[model samples]
Target: MASLGIVLHASLICIVLLTFFSGTASRNIANEILQRLEMVEKLNFDLKKENSNLKLEMIDIKGELKDIVNEMKVWMKSRHSQGNNKMNESNSDLQKENIKIKLEMAELRDQMDNVVRENCEMKKKWNELDDILISVYIHLNKSKPEIQSGIMPEHRTPLSYQHVAENRKANSVRSVQRIVPPAPDVTEQPVAFYAYMDSYHTPGLPIHTTLIFDTVQLNDGHGYSKHDGVFIAPRTGVYVFHWTIQTEVHSWESIEIVVNGSPIGCAASDTLRINDYGTGSGLVATRVNTGDLVFLRTHESISGYLLSNHRLRSSFSGWLLYS
Candidate 1:
């Protein structure tokens, strides 16, 4: 009976031990599950925070993109407007240039037409002048025989007019002798020269400056030098020298005819009105010895252009009256 009681006590002890161990294992398992749930909750809270931050960043990015788009549109519009304005301005400038060219062309055409008309008129005038010259030449030939013959038929007049008729006849003969040139002689050399300036002389000529006449029309005795614009007397005789000077409008000049360093004649040309050119002439008849120097010079300081052109000329001429 004692062995049986001992076995019951052991079994009771084993039962209590097993119940305590089971209770401890269940409590440990419950604590582990609660820890796992807490960790998952913490992870979910962190994810939510990260999502909110990402949304805020996206909002900021969207605002920046809108600003960039608006700026690009404004820039594009400004560039297009500027290009159109530049094109318009360039077109206007080109049009203005074209108009100016057209105007210039029109002016050139008008000038050409006017020149053509003037040329036609000049041709007609030249023909008329030729006719006049032909008539004069014919008349001169007809009168040559009469001039050579010294016979004059006496007209029948009343006794009271006899002395008057004689005087008139004598005067006519004398006038004829003066007008006609003497027949050419082998021994005698005719002395004559004529020259004109080729172009306008510059203003402000110095005092005592020799005026050059470079365009020689005639130099029969070969006494005129184009290099120095001086004529050296070829023979001792009486000489008649004449000179003409032209000055521009609103200007004045004084010139002199010089012979052997002495002033033989003085002339002045002055113009006070616009387009009114001035011309002055001087004439001198004096005895000139062989090798005497004759020229034209500025008498005083000049004040304007000394004009010499096709229409107006400054000329010097000289001829021997007798030698």
Candidate 2:
């Protein structure tokens, strides 16, 4: 019985030991499970943190892309504006050049017009000169025929009754009658008298005097003295007159008669002074018309006595007189 009891006690001790060991094992297993849980939670937290950082990197990249796009747009707009400006400047330059060319063309046209006008005026003057030369040539040619004809006679002679009688005596009456008179004589009265006297000298005679010109009057026989020193013509025709004068000394004295400021006749004496009286007498028969004023004029100082002789003459010679 004692042995059985001891065996039971030992078995109880073994059982207790086994139970302690089981408890220790169970404790270790629980500890291991708790550690494994802790590790899992840490790994989960790490994964979540890495995911958030990746999301932040993606947002920054998107912002940078937006800025690049905006910059490119601004650059393009500036380029476009520059291009438009260049085009406008080119157009303005072209317009200015065109206007300048037009002005130059207008000036050239004006110059051409002036040149053409001058040429036409010169042509007209040349034509007028040519016409004048042609007229002069025609006049000279017409006169050639008259100069060739022998209708004119030679020698100058007076055609009067006394001249005819003398010619009849020289040649026979038949020959004298066959010869025609050179000029025809007509009876003419004095219309106006023109007298000229030399300058007055202390002891000299007058240079010239008119005899018939002083004696004849317009209505009847009336003589004119030195006081009435002028004569006016009443009618228009040729008149005859004679002049005579005596000088005691020789001198360069001249007398001139002018009508309408034109000299018609003049007498001059160029002789030395002498104690005896010297006479210088002449007859001037001139054809004077109406409206002619006659006066006396002298060239040098002279003074003396004047005497005129009555003589009849013809005034058929050519003399210009104003009417």
Top candidate, metric TM-score: 1
- Candidate 2: misplaced stretches above 4 Å? 1-50, 133-323
Worst 10 residues of 1 by lDDT: 172-181
- TM for candidate 2 is 0.30
For model 2, residues 1-323, the per-residue Cα lDDT tens digits are 44355546655655665666677765665556556555755666687789999899889888899898998899998999998999989999999999999999999999999998996675465446434433443343234443223122234333432344344334322121011111122133222333333232234423222112222223210112222233333334554444444444444445556443334766655456655545554445555433343434444345553322233221111122322
lDDT of each: 0.70, 0.44
Instruction: Compute each candidate's TM-score over C-alphas.
Output: 0.42, 0.30
The digit string of per-residue lDDT tens for model 1 on 147-227 reads 234232243232221233244334421111111222234148688999898876577775656677878899876667554
Error of 2 at 163 (Å): 68
User: Where is model 1 more than 4 Å wrong at Cα?
Assistant: 1-187, 273-275
